[model samples]
Target: MTESSIEANYNRAKLEADKVDLLIAEALENGCSFLVEAGAGSGKTYSLNQAAAWVQENKWAEYRKNAQSAVCITYTNAAVEVIKERLPENSPVLPRTIHAFAWEAIKQYQSFLVKTVTENLDYMPDEGDFARVDEVRYTLGNRYRENGVQYLYHDDVLKLFCELLDNGKFRRMFADRYPLILIDEYQDSYGPIVEKFVEYFIEPGAAPQFGFFGDAWQTIYQSNKACGAISSDWLKVIRKGSNFRSAPRIVRLLNDIRPDLPQTSAIDGFEGEVVVITNDDYSGSRRNDRNFKGELPPDVLRERLDEVTGLIRGNVLPEETTKTLMITHKVLASQQGYDELLAIIGDALRDEEDVFLIFFKDVVEPVYRALCESDHAGLFEALGVKRYPINKKSDKIRWHELRRSLESARNSKAIDVVNAVVGSGLVPIPPKIEGWMSLYRGDSSTLYASSASIGQYLGLDYQQFVAAIEFLQPDASFSTEHGVKGEEYDNVVFAIGRGWNLYQFDVYAPMITGQVPIPSGKQASFERNRNLFYVCCSRPRKRLFFFVSIPLSLEFRSFLHDLAGEENCYTYGDFLREWPERTIAACVKNGAS
Candidate 1:
């Protein structure tokens, strides 16, 4: 290797090898349990992998056999994929989401494996046997109804799962597995499910090893729909407080906010000025439309987005390194409509090589389209009739071919196919069919519940859905606040529009709710927003920008500025004040570059 290459490798090797043995030793020590407080970019995953290796090595050494395997649980599908990808080849670490792990464990036990879920209500007799689902929905909805609240489906599922585990089902499954349980983003797992895991799986004599990684600053979501935190009660806490992901200058900014941070080698000796633009001149006249109470008007936000795009085109380094993350405090409540903003941004960033965005509304379409392309056949088999499998397969193949034809046709956007498949008159729904097939939500009551139904009814069984999916015009990537957890970007710009104000779990609500004095939760929520902001900003590892569109309500605006560093904050109007003379020129230059 050349001198520089050898030196670079030596430096990385030294960091990796340093104290790695100590971490492993602690994890494997008998009667050992640890709750590690790892900040973003702190190699938390590395530590977890190291611990898993220690567990496996000890199992083989002590018992003369491989252990069941270490269980590493994270909150998001992306994290699951990341863990799986990052793990060393041939490593036996079993990283999965809590839900996936739960389902897997339940699958091993016959009674826990549910064949079907029947939702039957007395007044809604047409519904099937969702006895428990009905009760909890009624109970939670009734309580929230009087208070003007909406209860989600999985919230109750979390409570029910917890109840089952607390009652010993969870414990019984893990009784002999010798599985080491590792939790990531622990703050997001605080509901009954987590309590049950701790009480039954960790606290009891299960003797499984435990490794927890998460920042106390970024605990935004939990099953309880409340603020999440790293409680004082967790056993044997070890804080991985230093940030290896951020430059020293950025670390200083975070540390100024959080004084108790640990020291680490994530980022050191890097210097950069932190710029906070408080845009005060832009009046948010657009989002005030009375029709949508909790959304930033897409047009208004789009205007602000245009300005930020202008700045990025002019100033950001390494062009493609710049990524803008438009995060609202709440995705569901945004009035501006996520899809509309996404369509607009996709247009703005369409040509920019380095500039990318994470918007909530439009990110899933591509994934759905991709899945239909790759797994359309498997999906058909899983959901379609067994006796008529060949018939189904033939239809799917034809659909795939047709979609390919549509793309090959050129000039026409795929909306023609979408309309043909979903719109009126293609395949008339039987008058006997009570519910319209939902192309979006996969519920059985809906006549065509999944992509499978669309293919099945359209006689695509002869071809495949891949053809139909091929016609879908690709949109930009935008994730919900919840969606971007455990994910990071270098330059993050939050469009904390009206949605954050409308959503029930806005993280700012706890600050509004006097019932719980969880400033930490509120702070954590703000910090989670900030953490997400930091995550998106730190993602580039070079620059960060926050574009928080002013909301119609001053209250909402104040909440955003508070979370986004009031001193460094700016409004859309603020950009108009400076009117960077080169703004338009910058866009042209950046676009050209």
Candidate 2:
């Protein structure tokens, strides 16, 4: 390994290694509220753990008692789990999701009835407790209907929670409970909610120490205004530049596109190609139709997939190739063109030694199971899947019974519903008494569907839903303009759809960097679209194959032509001057012509 590689790894370790110890050291040296800006993959949770440890240690030494409490406000339940997992073995940090933290703080000073009233007003109680809140929501819906107000989205739940906190009683509850606070993914948090914290939790002279971590680039998700207060001038800002997940070559390529990114040491020794694919060479407008002209067709996508998959299969390295991933936009993934490509890859890899065909679409079912928390057999019945290894009629009966049990629980006590869903982990249910109970009262919905789906379909329960989802996740390896984010994958194949040409600054240039100013609504859409495209192009680490359906864009074509005068890194045939007649032939043969 190079010296830079060693340094990169060391830097990563410094942020993640016994981070709590360093946090304590800093806290002991300065009692002033400390603000930390954590970047992507910068070990934000580890730092929080260290800060909590410091609080507990100093409280015992100086005050002969435990610190009042440390509150960690995170964006998601998954973030809560990550913090819990990273805390010191016996750490006392009260890590929780923002809503959970808020609820716990508010619940302490309020009566159960008051808390119940708050929950009813806001439809965010747990599944078992949904009825109480649902009743309130229904009533509110009727009242709102009379007033021309609409039903609620999930965020309205937090809005109601904030309303309750606006009352002095609940505000004091949070202030008195946790003395120090750390928030993760605070960027995605609701703005009003954070403002509430500043108003209520910020101690006048000695505010609680605060640490936060997130990236504005990836903050393309909703709620941009939420973390506005935590921006550079108001808060201490530190950028974690290194990407622990992607290889250096991949990072470099991505940086080339997004030059404003922070320079981090995380990408030191990694090397790989980041190819850009496009279709531009079509000389004749054989088909002048608006949809068909100079665009990627199904056959072209299929051919690219086969070619890309074949290239990777040729360059085998035991477990190394598993990291390559193919990522496309949500639209592309759902397209018939993508389906054809999958079939091509599948056929090409059927006899290949170590290659695996992982379709990103497969993740949907597992995620659905996670949401529903029910058996796949019941779902199959619900989805109208009749054929199974076991008797079809028997499975349908079991499905009906499971639905009946769910309705019963919904009508009965809320706890009864929770208990039933949390009871059965993953076992398939019969229509019998025990099966109905097992299927309903269970904590592991993901497990139940995964096991049931594989059992009935493949004759063996495969507890691999999580693995499968991860395996097919978006990764940073492909050359397609759309790169994956928030997930990683191995072994990527790039299938630049016919839409690649649309990325030319000259094509969509009017929306950005052009004389014609974009409309505000269209401007927002373009920004989001650009951010998403950039995210998708950075998901691979290994070999990259360019499967261009047409050719190159106007700017790209000019650039390539200019480059041809200086170097030969690419091929002339890679440029498309004419749409392949074969595509039309194939499309007609498949009856899509």
Candidate 3:
């Protein structure tokens, strides 16, 4: 990768963001619903801000007269800020998350909301359902109760609102409140809610004018299609053609991948390095062997990523300039030597009664991280000091001795750490772990992973167990492609294989590379994989590298060479040849503390 360093000159985009903003301004003037197909790094937010400002300036008088404020509906709070910041001071434009927007419509209809929650949904409260929304204590709403408190999931918000769309008066009242509605990142909008919005509002010429703004190629958040009937021809189509992120060559690769919505780079003459690394020769079996599964075995996969990352840091790009992006957290956990923890973690993580989870999260993790940082205050905090002081009152001098003992505990086995935590009499053991006293006494080796793996997991080395738990924490060294969405860097190390059930790159590669025709039945899935791949590829400003594990057919491999250029197509051996002399560099040092 040293040979593929980022280019020296970073010529900023020559194209004006005003081009799209002006188009959006004019589109709003026409008074028709429109969808802006803003591509990656096209400054879609800038366009949105500009459009909202235009609405505020030109339509404020009309909205004020009608007693309505235009609403900018987006998915995340961060996006709401992006739209809200650029609006005029005390502007009539109100930017809100879809959840907040739905809450506004349904909060006044308390009786109706309660009816929808109790009658339509399955989560019936144990003490009988709430009579009012104010009475219902909501952490998030879906389930009727959680931890003896009435609450729900986030999905419940959307579900309740979707149910309300069936009522003509609710739709009319919502339209009366908001004469203009703009949904940014509309592609990832909730499916059922967005569908009902189309049915009740957009399709039938409702009062509010609708504007959907997002790139279909960047809709990688969902496994299936996100924006449903919004793609229909009823809405006026607008394409923001300029890409202000990647260099000229990187844009060319993207254009080849997606010809339908081709991009014009803001850089007129800037060149970029595009390197593709593939392991076509490695022989490793999938844990569950099947033709559909493409990910290498966990250990083998770790080896592959480490070698590739080493080459990338020493040769291709420096650790400071490059960001490593994987497909999922599980994939990254495997690369970090902690994926084994993910198996037990996948099942009922919210179950408070699970002894393993309680021990890991509370006692082990907090103590482990505190010791690593050499913070005695943090250690004491984990021991439930301060507001909840150390329960077992021994000699106060013992706190000093415990620090040294706990620091050395990392060298002991995992079961030993658990026993020390429980036996030290420094902290009261949870009732759940006490209940499992019989299981803990048994030999871990005798317990099967399928039935009794908690003991077996506890039997691992404490160092390894702590490391696994740390990997489960948010690590900046490696990230999922989804995490880096709408983010750009000087260079990127994009590792592509398959870890998730739906992200089948093996099937998607041939379709994009022209080895086979795209199937109609798998069209949604193809788009899903393609959108993710495109999202990863288009993140780098000066240099882009793709390290793929799924062995591609010869024809598709050659197609990659042709697409990326022969000069940039790299083999695994090229990386291995230089590895013996170089030290591996981490993208980020990820000690959990």
Candidate 4:
């Protein structure tokens, strides 16, 4: 807390940042490939943007002389937009998702791909293959026609591009087209595909420079193995250790909890409060009882809500600034988890419908209704028909006449329907409609099945989606740990419980306190919970309160006391005893204010 201590922390953090800057400079100046293991709050995005800017400033002149542009690939569209906005207006950096980049390649090589596949393979064109590109479904086998061009499936487009990269000629051409390639969130990239890309493009020195930036510890997605598979030996690998987001106290808490990760420090010298409340008195006995299955009892859930309510009322400044984080590991296990969550959060909730519901409302129902009404104009308008040419020569065409002609031609297959709609030339194929066609191209039964009739089949998905959406609302006081990543608040009340399938506080307590190693079969569960807890705890800018469903072990309790100070650690009973009734009701009704 002293000025000297703050100065020391700031100096140490500066050294770490300088080290990262040096590594980036070395890679950019030497035209070498590099990978950075950026820890939480290490400013990974900033580093990536700097690298991109360096590429544009240093390597872009030569690349432009060769008619090529630098490429920056990221995992999410939002990230791409952010990076795009940060780069200079005339910068050569072309920010895109891996899929979007693959689509561009497919468009450029469509003719060549048509000739090569047709000449080299035994292609069978089915009725469904009418005018589509060779559909390369990764899970499904590749389908190509021996003669004509077809639209490429999303996965197939990536597959063909990877295959083309394997060819020496295509690899050189691609390298020439993209002299510098920087991948953000590289740890989340698909393993096999990235491996192939590295082998053909990076390792062979095909591209002038390459950069991969991401935090391996934050690899929460299932396909994380690919991140580890990337060869660290060939690239200049750097580990960035300073924390620029969280307070110093939070940084220290993360250090204790996730000591396995790279060492980190809070560069900003900000100090904040960390509170730990044990549920041992309430749920202690049931902690180790695996046989005790199902949702937590209502009394226990109510007690948790009461504790959160009290904290929000007393500790949260402006009360409305409180953010409560809960976890639902098995949202679809049963509706019980979501129901309990809703009941606990009460009125502080806002929900959004899932993608399927939105898609059904926006596209499917309209198209289906138009088809049934035999209104060609209505159908075309619903399809968002804009620039494609129509064959009728007349301003309007009767649906009955068109349907009769199509039926007489025996084009009744689902693919036939898609082709008629798409090939009609009256409407340009939109991405959403194309996606729908892809989903039911081979089987149209689902297309004709009305949403009303198929409600049962969609019931669970719809419920989960709505719950997730509500939990994610910015104005809502409550959210799931997974939903609150990358979000920060003045006060955060994190609830740890069992309904989330594997996230039992009893098991997590031991692992967190170093009293027990993560069990063999439960490594995945343990790591997930660890990451979730880390994310939730680090979200509070000023104060953090944890509410565990079960009691902490003696060792875990002592560990918490030491990490967050004895005054900050309390039993749930003690918390209730100290807080007044009105505060509790306020939290339960409208959140902690």
The TM-score leader among the candidates is 3
TM-score of 2: 0.56
The all-Cα superposition gives candidate 4 an RMSD in Å to the true structure of 12.0
Which runs of model 2 end up more than 4 angstroms from their true locations? Answer: 1-67, 88-90, 109-157, 198-206, 223-229, 257-261, 267-269, 281-294, 321-484, 490-523, 542-593
Cα TM-score per model:
0.58, 0.56, 0.77, 0.67
Which 10 residues in a row give candidate 2 its minimum summed lDDT? Answer: 352-361
Q: What clash pairs does model 3 have? A: 1-315, 1-316, 2-315, 2-316, 140-152, 141-152, 141-153, 142-152, 142-153
- Candidate 1, residues 1-593, lDDT tens digits: the string is 56565345235533653465365466567556667666666667777666666655665454334446667888778878887886665555678776666645543433331211223121222323323322222222121211222222333334435545655545665644645677887766745666665676566646565667666556545334532554435467766644556555455555544457634434322333244443445545544454335444566555566566566545544444443444441232122232322233332322322111211012223323433576545434433324432357766575565445434432232223344333323122332221233432354332332223333332222112232222122322343454455555545554444444333223442243232345643553544454544344444343455554443245544543443456545455654454355344443454353
Candidate order, TM-score descending: 3, 4, 1, 2
Per-residue lDDT for 30-129 in model 4, tens only? 8888888777777788888888877777866776777888788888789889988888887888999887887665556656676655554433334354
Q: How close is candidate 1 to the true structure, as a TM-score?
A: 0.58
Give me candidate 4's TM-score against the actual structure: 0.67
Task: Give the per-residue lDDT of model 3 (tens digit) for 480-548.
Answer: 777788788877888878777777665676677577689879888887888888888888886787787
User: In candidate 4, where is summed lDDT lowest over 10 consecutive residues?
Assistant: 452-461
Candidate 2 lDDT, 241-289, residue by residue in tens: 4555555555555555455553342533334444434444334343334
- Best-to-worst order by lDDT is 3, 4, 1, 2
Instruction: Kindly report which residue pairs in candidate 4 clash with one another.
Output: 132-150, 132-151, 133-150, 133-151, 280-551, 312-592, 313-592, 319-593, 389-425
**Selected candidate, larger TM-score, 2 vs 3:** 3
Q: Rate the local accuracy (lDDT) of all candidates.
A: 0.46, 0.44, 0.69, 0.61
Top candidate on lDDT is 3
- List ranges where model 1 is wrong by over 4 Å: 1-21, 63-67, 76-93, 104-173, 201-206, 222-227, 230-234, 262-270, 283-300, 328-480, 502-540, 551-593
